[model samples]
Target: MIRIACLIVMMMAGMLRAEVDARPDARVAARDAAQRLDAAARQMDKATTAKDRVKALSETVHAYEDGLDAMRDGLRRATVQEQRISRELKAREIEISRLLGVLQSIGAAPAPATLLHPDGPVGTARAGMVLADIMPGVNSEAASLRAQFEEVTTLRLLQKSATETLQKGLVGAQEARTALSQAVADRTDLPRRFTADPVRTAILIASTETLEGFASGLSQITDAEGGAPLPDISHRQGTLPLPVQGQVLRRAGEADAAGIQRPGIVMATRPQALVTTPTAATIRYRGPLLDYGNVMILEPQTGLLLVLAGLDVVYGHAGEVLPAGAPVGLMAGDPALSGEILQETPAGMGIGSGNRRSETLYIEIRQDNTPVDPELWFETDKDD
Candidate 1:
């Protein structure tokens, strides 16, 4: 029975790990966020306008927010595990009563004699019957004791790690939030694009009935100011670079788990990976969109636009002429395998979390507001 129970625990543990293998690691997340803060600081140093400064600080704020959120979740999950262990310890105390009684009476002559009896027919038969009745209780008590010790140790370690992460996140978030506030307060150095009529653009975005209409409206607003230098990207067909390094999980028109088929490529990438432009492009719009997280729309030519979405942070704003390979943003992820589930499992994992997010990027190329296969313009050798 002891062996069987141990086997059950082992199987359960494996299943838990399997489901959470996609979880971002805590330490890795902390480290990645710290690195991102440095990058944002550098960008802030070079920012000449209020919009640019705000863009840099926005990255910092996003990194801090993600880190703080992950740390809080980790701490919360660890506390729940500690509570569960406490409950198990209490249950074990009740379960061991019979085993404890047997142990106390082991010094009695009959019990000891029967347990230590030689293998003769009569003695062996009597001993076997007594052992059968006692072994299960004894084995169960031992298994529970072993499991309790291990559980306590694991909980303690998890709590300690979470505490450290929380401390780091708190410090980072505070500093970044302060800097972001200061950056936003500066209105004297606002850029021309930021000074543009935002109400009309907002109205256009709000009134657009479809993505094509929205893109077309954006193009009207983004029309090159008569003499702005185009990036000459129209010639780079069937060989444009990938925006970020990742494995292609889905091609254009592939139906996803949500049953929505769209003209885009979905790529699974590592946590906090750097997202960049494949060619020099003009930032038409970069910000949050409904259900897409952070999205960036960049135009490399007059009628063509590249759309990249599902990021933790975006680095540029509208009207910025981004050079090829310029960093656009960073994706979500951490180095550790941590699960964030919206509902509780049988084992009580993710009992109080809000949602689970998968790190998959969606890329779409639009030619004059019409969706087209991105593979035709991207390097075939690169993640084809």
Candidate 2:
């Protein structure tokens, strides 16, 4: 019965260890993300046209971002698991010491003495039965301890190697960003709905103080009365992707930190993150306006407008018709250095935190010059 109880405990310990090992491998995820970055880099190199280069570089940037995110997450898990294993080992220190001593003693005993007892055959038979039952439990514990030590070693190595991985990703992302900016500047293939009148635009800006007033008067900036109709994405209402990668900071009509409210959605994005047009649209205006930093006003369809603000650099010109996923702008803020990222991100491993996404992109949808909630048109849950 004592032997049976020891066997059961051994089985339970094995099961618990298996449960701990069932978690997804962090290193594997990081490796896969790195491969994606490699592929994107090759694609960027092979690009022939300005548009293709822009697309490829955009993909490369995304790949590096994903790889870095994976790296951070992997390091965090490794650190946590290493700490946990250390604690477990420390807690069982005395038990393991006693176990080693017992094993040493068993090995040192003579073969005959190990199997026999002074009381003779009956006593020896009882002693043999106890040893058989307890040996399995002892062996299982020793194996578990060995595994924990090996895992700790691996986790430490992972953390040490992460710095190099992070540095490479940061350099790759920056290069891609530089190439993307040049590509956008050289791009001239997009169709034009109409050329903007800078004098009229200046007049409109001088006349309007509010976004509503400016939007309502946008038609006066250009003389084109009925430009080519844009693709109708009316059926895609409530399913359009956000212009940039980010989480929704505030929904339409939600008051901000100062209790000021606006009929637009605020998205928190990483510094220098690429902003693409969700659908093919004609640019109406691009530049600073009112209190908004830098804004891009797009007309997706007649009577329907999409306003994206808070960009550091707005791409394309007013009246240029862009296809879906075209480079529109970049969110304001410099990319965090790789060293800073490694030092600051261990405590906050997620990309949704303010430390990761320091820039904000404000989006608003207007129909016939009336502001409407952006959530009604965009797929906000994609970030979640």
For all candidates in order, the CA lDDT equals: 0.62, 0.77
Model 1: lowest-lDDT 10 consecutive positions: 187-196
Candidate 2 residue-wise lDDT, 1-384, digit = tens: 334445445544665377357656767765665666566566556653444777777766776766666666665666666666677677767656766777777888999979888879998998888888788787777677787788778777776776567666777777888888988898777788898889999999999999999999998779764556776778999988889987899988899999999999999888888899998899999999999999999999889999999999999999888888888888877676332544334433222221377789999999988898888898877355
The candidate scoring highest on lDDT is 2
Off by over 4 Å in 1: 1-95, 107-147, 153-157, 160-171, 174-209, 217-280, 285-296, 307-317, 323-350, 354-364, 373-384
User: Between which residue pairs do clashes occur in model 2?
Assistant: none
Clashes of 1: 4
Clashes of each: 4, 0
Candidate 1 backbone collisions, by pair = 23-338, 24-336, 25-336, 271-333
Compared to the true structure, candidate 1 yields what TM-score?
Answer: 0.48
lDDT of 1 by residue, 320-380 (tens): 6666776677777652322332234554333354223347889999987789999988874
What ranges in model 2 sit over 4 Å off?
1-19, 48-51, 108-123, 337-341, 344-355, 382-384
